[model samples]
Target: MGYHFKFEKIMSVKEREKNEALSAYNDSVKRFEEVAEKLYELLKKKEDLESYQSMKLVSGLPVLEIRHHQQFIVNLQKSIEQYQKMVQNARNHMLFQQEKLMHKNIEVKKFVKMKEKGLHEFLEEVKHVEAKQMDDISIQHFVHRGS
Candidate 1:
């Protein structure tokens, strides 16, 4: 007899759900990396600007120009802060989605293992039946030969 799992459909649905959850988690990770890279680039720009401002100090630039540079630095800092938040939120979302994916994976694995175990038992039963039939046929052949 063919081995059949009663909950095979449910297992398949759970497998699909796991795949979707994994994709969502991967997207979240990508978004977090993008925001983090933007933040890192912004910080590097601020450092370079500071270096330029130090060079201007030796030449004694105008006060207005100094103020403008400082304002730009402040704006950059704010942008970095916002991007940091976005990265953090994305990280949190990735973690949540990962948890969901893990659960779905476990659910599907449980059913798959159960089905495998059932199939193993079914194959063993078939082997036993086949062996008994072989023995019965061999005994009948021997008895006819003796007669």
Candidate 2:
């Protein structure tokens, strides 16, 4: 004997949508991490360049070299700032999505529990009916045989 509930299919649909949103949020987080990593590398490179500039023994280094170092440092600062903001924003969005997912999961769980409870009740009812019918049949057979 099988017991089925009408809301099972609706729960599946809600689960699928929540999963898809989570996947997309994860992808965004990964992209933000990559950008942050690249920014860190650029900052490191800029620091190395600054260190080299300070360690120069020759006082007559070309003006172009000095200008290049300055420009590189500025660009690295801007990149770091931009990526930091991006990472923060992505993290915030991910948090919001996670909260939404949690709520959705809670809803689905409630529906699932309800469906299970309903199915259990239905099974119990079926069993009771079957048992009653068997008792009736046995009583009738006994009476007929006795007569």
Assess each prediction's global lDDT (C-alpha) against the native. 0.90, 0.82
Model 1, position 84, has a per-residue lDDT of 86
User: Estimated TM-score per prediction?
Assistant: 0.91, 0.79
56-90 per-residue lDDT for model 1 (tens digits) = 98999899999999999999999989988888888
Off by over 4 Å in 1: none
Q: Judge candidate 2 at residue 60 and give its lDDT.
A: 59
Candidate 1, pairs of clashing residues: none
Task: List candidate 2 segments past 4 Å from native.
Answer: 57-64
> What is the C-alpha lDDT profile of model 2 across 32-54, one tens digit per residue?
77877877787788789888888
All models, RMSD in angstroms: 1.4, 2.7
For model 1, state the Cα shift of residue 117 in Å: 0.8
Task: For model 2, state the Cα shift of residue 56 in Å.
Answer: 3.4
Q: Candidate 1 — what's its lDDT?
A: 0.90
